[model samples]
Target: MRTEFDFAPLYRSSIGFDRVFNLLNNAQRLHAIDNWPPYDIVKTGEDDYRITMAVAGFAEGELDVTQERNVLVVKGGRADKQEGEYLHRGIGSQSFERRFELADHVKVETAKLANGLLSIALRREIPEAMKPRQIAISSGLSDQTAPLQIEAEKQVA
Candidate 1:
């Protein structure tokens, strides 16, 4: 049995949240995708993250990691020269593409492949203008000097 969600009602009720709805729809679509060459996502710091993928048998030249806007794409492929026939093909030897959704201001800092593992580091740097800041609040008009009355400044002429 398959279940599907109807977002029409939400679309009609909510305004200025198109991005949120789109993200939800994209997440639902990602659930049915293939999980090959297992990977892990870790939060290393408050705004730092790391993604590691088990990429055995894949050389550094055969893997490509790219960040486009708010999406991270990792692709792996082998030319398949057919070195030999495997009695039991346990390890994945097929091309794969993986995508990760990133929030605004998130960026890929570094990527390295070693010991059959591919690791990518990410950090989120919010702009100074976008970051929360303390605003000066006035308790009341008492905080400022009262305006000088025009009549008081003028003498009987």
Candidate 2:
């Protein structure tokens, strides 16, 4: 059983949240129930993050990692190859793609594969102009007691 949410009301009242609403709508539409090759996300630091996925039977050449705009995509699979028949197969070796939504300014730093794990490192690099800074408030002419007066008596015809 599943339920769908209506975001029309929120769109009418909210501002500067179009992305959020779009993400919610996309999530509802995808509704993917696949959970193979389990992964974990962790906040390594204030501006750093990490994603680790367990891919027991995959190789470096069979995986791909890419980021476009605010989305991170990780795909794993290998080209079809004939091999000896196995008496009993236990490992999961199938094509899979995982997507991650990243906030603004968040970028992928590096990706590493070791033992049976794939680790992706991310960092938030906000631009200098976007980072918060102290503003200097100044007391302008408002503090002056006398108002300026124009002297035009000599030029009067």
Candidate 3:
């Protein structure tokens, strides 16, 4: 079965979400799906995530993890070997390309392979300026003067 995606409606909506519309319009990126070596994305902690991919026959040297422009790419390819006679060959060795979408500010922490599973951890740190802050209220009017209007001064400044 084949599936087609239409991004015309998204562009016509004009809901001020240009980022989403632009992403949808980029067909080259939209069609890139990782089907080889099934994987899972799990949220382990606050702002923490882990991506586990099943690479049964792939070795550490054959796999590579890299981040390019907010995209996590994992590629695996076995080294070429001379054809040898095998009476019973059950293990399958194939090359694959996997891509993952990462949000702004999200970065790859580390990657490790163990027990045929390749685990990649990611973390995002919220900027201090973007975090919420509590406002302090004055208990009473000061002896010199009451609360002065700072908006006018801010505007002039």
Which candidate gets the maximum lDDT versus the true structure? 2
Which ranges of candidate 3 are over 4 A from the true structure?
1-16, 24-34, 82-90, 138-157
Q: List the residue pairs that clash in candidate 1.
A: none
Give the winner by lDDT: 2 or 3. Answer: 2
lDDT of 2 by residue, 53-129 (tens): 99987999999999999999999997666598789878888899999999999999999999999999999999999
Worst window of 10 by summed lDDT in candidate 3: 25-34
Stretches off by above 4 angstroms in model 2 are 138-147, 151-157
Model-by-model lDDT, in order? 0.91, 0.93, 0.83
lDDT of 2 at 115: 98
List TM-scores for all candidates, in order: 0.85, 0.85, 0.70
Q: Give the C-alpha lDDT of model 1.
A: 0.91
Residue-wise C-alpha lDDT for candidate 3, range 46-137, written one tens digit per residue: 99999999998788999999999878999999975758987987665678888777877899999999999999999987788988999987
**lDDT at position 125, candidate 1:** 98
Backbone clashes counted, model 3: 0
